[model samples]
Target: MPENPVDPPGLDLARLRAHLDRELPGTVQGPLDAELIEGGRSNLTYVLTDGTGRWVLRRPPLGHVLATAHDMGREHRVMTALGGTGVPVPGTLLLDPGTETLGAPWYLMDFVPGTAHRDAAPLAGLGAPRVHAIGERLVDTLAALHRIDPAAVGLADFGRPDGYLERQLRRWSTQLAASRSRELPGVDRLHGLLAARLPESPVPALVHGDYRLDNVLVDEHDAVAAVLDWEMSTLGDPLTDVGLLVMYTELAGVGGGIIPSAATAPGFPSAGELVARYAGLTGREAADLDWYVAFASFKLAVVAEGIHYRFRQGSTLGAGFERAGEIAPVLAEHGLTTLKER
Candidate 1:
């Protein structure tokens, strides 16, 4: 067992080292050091090093975890299944389902080196052509992901795709209800409008539920290195992912400094361009994406509300949580306007 001078919150370094030694011997050659990675609102991510090798570990949040929200096994299984596919994902190394070691199920994967640009300033310095190319590649990668057959990747049973959009609406509504603390104007109306106008979903594909520029890591050559954060991945209406991407890009700076976005940087593709590029690559009709975008806005509003709830309850970890509440109403208003315009 490695000496533990200090263990970061939500991690037990000595037990983790012992488990690693037992599961995969000699993986750790020296003292293990870990630091919790910030900016994660759901799963707790950490970067670990043993003076030789570096890896990443993910686990559920420390306290007040929802029953089905943070499934470590699901994340591991999806990434492992997509290993051979064109989608770039971190190579999963091990999954510990039992809670004996870390008090919760956790998994580790190779830490791919790249930059996850969350803000627009750095990307603005990258010049317009490079940023534009990166944006195009981002869309192209998403198209490739949507083109994959779930069964071919051993993920046919990953999630039930039938009526995915409808179920998604219900799920988020329940989530919002669970986290509701104060009245949010327009949220209920947005939800009602979405329920009244659910579009016919196209053929389902494996969807990265939260697809955005920052969720992916880009390499020096401006290619996507690996897509990160698969807690939300499932077999669903692929356009839901597209709509989320478009929403993030469109609402880049509207989060009151709570939501970080690189999409607003100079040379990044416009929301319209991104939608068109995705349509061109996947040959899917994007004409009826207005509803999808509106739903995306509503979904994000729910998520922001959830975060605000946690913050108010004093259960949220890290900085900038207090500002999350401000974004919910803004997103709800945007969602309402989107539906009204259609």
Candidate 2:
């Protein structure tokens, strides 16, 4: 749990207690031990415990968020939708979309206990086989998700099919313009190049907007216990998801990053291997994936920088924001480099 968790304003303690009483009943013997978990600035997460100390409860931040961006309902929806689908997700227990209860929307799920990493040591602990297994599982899981019909799952209204890439470029462009602390020359150039080279994407599927090793929790045996962070998830180009993962792979090598390979620990999958693994699962060639991959880098750069922006504004805590800002330049360089190579 991060120190000084940000509790959304208007959190309804009494309602939460009542809801828990109805849902968990006797399990919560006394006052629920609720502590806000840091690192989830986009959403508010709390580690809830019973008198005996068992953890549960994850929720979005209090206050209004972008309708298309931070909808907790969507987060809960995807988690609930993935139930029994081979994707390991924290078991969703309850969803409270109405603000009448917690002053904002929130959900309860089984707390998955495990190790998560950003710097390399934890990744090394997971070992090579498990890492590779995660790689395979990532592809297979996306394929399985893409295979599902959104209409069947009551998610037909999730995203628009047409102009996804275009809309995304414009959206992020706006975000950068709005929040950037200082101008980076490459930002505009990369944006222009991506706009010009927009390849036709396959029909939209559910894409986890931020798919990275850090967002996943691996159990002791080195298997992914849960795929956390679906705040950016939506029905979008499947290649975008692949592109994000690959970009993470590339950047991981330069810093404390995780590689998805069971044969080797803590090194990125060879470009050929990553594409092959994905293609094998989806029968979709990753040709011309450079644009999306670069876009992923750029998007992340802005997002990471946004952390710095927030911290400076006193919206978040921890010195991680400084390191996060550094990723912007690295990501921009990687995006441009990939563009040139492609």
Mark the regions of model 1 whose C-alpha exceeds 4 Å error after superposition.
1-5
- RMSD each, Å: 1.7, 3.9
Task: Pull out the clashing pairs in model 1.
Answer: none
* Location of the lowest summed lDDT over 10 successive residues in candidate 1: 253-262
> What Cα-based lDDT does every candidate model obtain?
0.89, 0.71
Candidate 2 per-residue C-alpha lDDT over 212-254 given as tens digits, one digit per residue, 9 for 90 to 100: 6667776766567788888888888888888888887666645
Best by lDDT: 1
Q: Flag clash pairs in model 2.
A: 44-61, 128-262, 129-262, 132-261, 132-262
Across 1-342, the per-residue lDDT of candidate 1 in tens digits comes to 356547988889989999999998988899999988888778889999987889999998776665567899999999999997899999999999999999999999999999998888998899999999999999999999999999998999999888898899999999898888899999999999899999988998999888988889999999999999999889989999998898888889677556666888999999999999999999998756889889899988887887788777777777777888899999999888877786
